[model samples]
Target: MSMVGNPVQVGRRPLDVDLIDRARAGDDHAFASLLGPIVASGYRLAGAMLHDRYAAEDVVQEASLKAWRSLRQLRAGAEMRPWFLGIVANECRSVRRTRWWSVLKFPDVESPAMPPDDPHTTFAELRRGIRRLRHRRRLMLVLHWYLDLPMAEIAVITRSSEDAVKSEVSRAMRQLRGLIGVEDA
Candidate 1:
């Protein structure tokens, strides 16, 4: 998938492969290019996990730096999205562990900007229900549903087996249903 006009191609390789090759050869532009598509997803993941946009931005920035420094460790032919998300997850966990006090001190600046529609109510309730879930379950739900990743990739990002990821997603959904007061059919 070459960018339009630029037409960067490395002998029929995929765009990511070409970018990875260039990045690994000390090309900073290629590294940024590789991260371009997935950066929004990474930010969304961080915001979901951290529940604070400022902190989430910081976590993503830190994760990007780590990804850049450790680009050599990324396996060939691997999907960069999940790999980068895993780093974001790890960074979120680290921030949570070390900066617990920040949660109390930091005020959430962004309110839920619901549109003038009835579905906004349901969306707010769902967000609240998701927030009430246990951290691991919430992370799994965000990764599976929000990020739309497969169970195997979720397992890799969360550092668990595929079976465990499946079970967590199931349990999380059930818990969310319960929290939202929706009876199981």
Candidate 2:
């Protein structure tokens, strides 16, 4: 369980269901096993939201700890991935609110694997536009678009109505397009 590679193999085990259940019952190993698979996904989501490697790592770590501590409070039928993501998202917000991580914005130390170079300025503009969005709306858009999550699941993680998620996503998209100067085609 390196938590940094091979998502397929890491989370492929059917034991996750059992592990989640046991972890919810206070088993530490079960909790560790439960978190191993989705940790990378959590990192990816947090990384996208924060756009900083170290900050994303911090968010993931904090979210994992919180999820573990509160695992027992989760509903029985709820899936772990979204639960974990929600925690990570919250951690990202906490880190951003502190504003100490803004030092990561300099290009020299930033991760180079951002969006593709095609349409050259698209990614840069998109990043800027994303930053312009209110924090909650930005998270919703990133979780929906980058993570490819449906509105229903995003609603679950964001703790908002599906309609609200839909509206936020819609507004975010509209704002992005407006910023990019692209009219409906």
Candidate 3:
């Protein structure tokens, strides 16, 4: 499945209880099928986090494996997207901490689609400014703005309260604007 398109909308998409049960019971096919949509979203999340397609792929792959191994840890009927994304986010963070992450000069991460034009700068320039953000701030922006995930879902991934997530996103945007040299107007 292509990891670039058709992200599942959280509330709009219904969870398949049967699929979850079978996957939780150790059915590989069921797990793969269930994880397909989530993985695509996870890939986007990882891509934004790691800034390298190969590293994003590796991070998502590792996250998928971790998700599979920890499937039992998922609460019954819990939303899988946030939970799996949390794993993916953690994997990206872990990869960034390793020595190899800095030795390589990975290409800049480009978003799948053109973002809305900013009067002050191009999207690519904006992305460069985003790169200057701290890891947690970057993760917040990626999860909240890039993924179009709701605050509650982002909260789950960040392990913060919804209010805290909201506050961080707002602060991150301000920091991004500052980094991009956009004066408050």
Best candidate according to lDDT? 3
**CA RMSD for every model?**
5.6, 6.9, 6.9
- For 1-185, candidate 3 gives per-residue lDDT tens digits of 33222243333465566666678899999898778877899999999987789989999999999989998887755678888999998898899888877686657656566545653347677879888888899999999889998998899888999999999999999999898878866
Query: Where does candidate 1 clash, by residue pair?
Result: none
For each candidate, the alpha-carbon lDDT, in order, equals 0.81, 0.76, 0.82
* Ordered list by TM-score, greatest first: 3, 1, 2
Task: Encode model 2's per-residue lDDT on 42-160: one tens digit a residue.
Answer: 98888888877887888898898898889876665566777788889889888888755655455533345555565545666778778777778888888888888888888888999
Model 2: ten consecutive residues of lowest lDDT: 3-12
Residue 19 in model 2: shift from native, Å? 2.8
Model 1 agreement with the true structure over 21-130: per-residue lDDT tens digits: 68989899999887887889899999998788998999999999999999988776566777889899889878877856345664324456666456866677788888
Off by over 4 Å in 3: 1-12, 106-121
Cα TM-score of candidate 3: 0.83
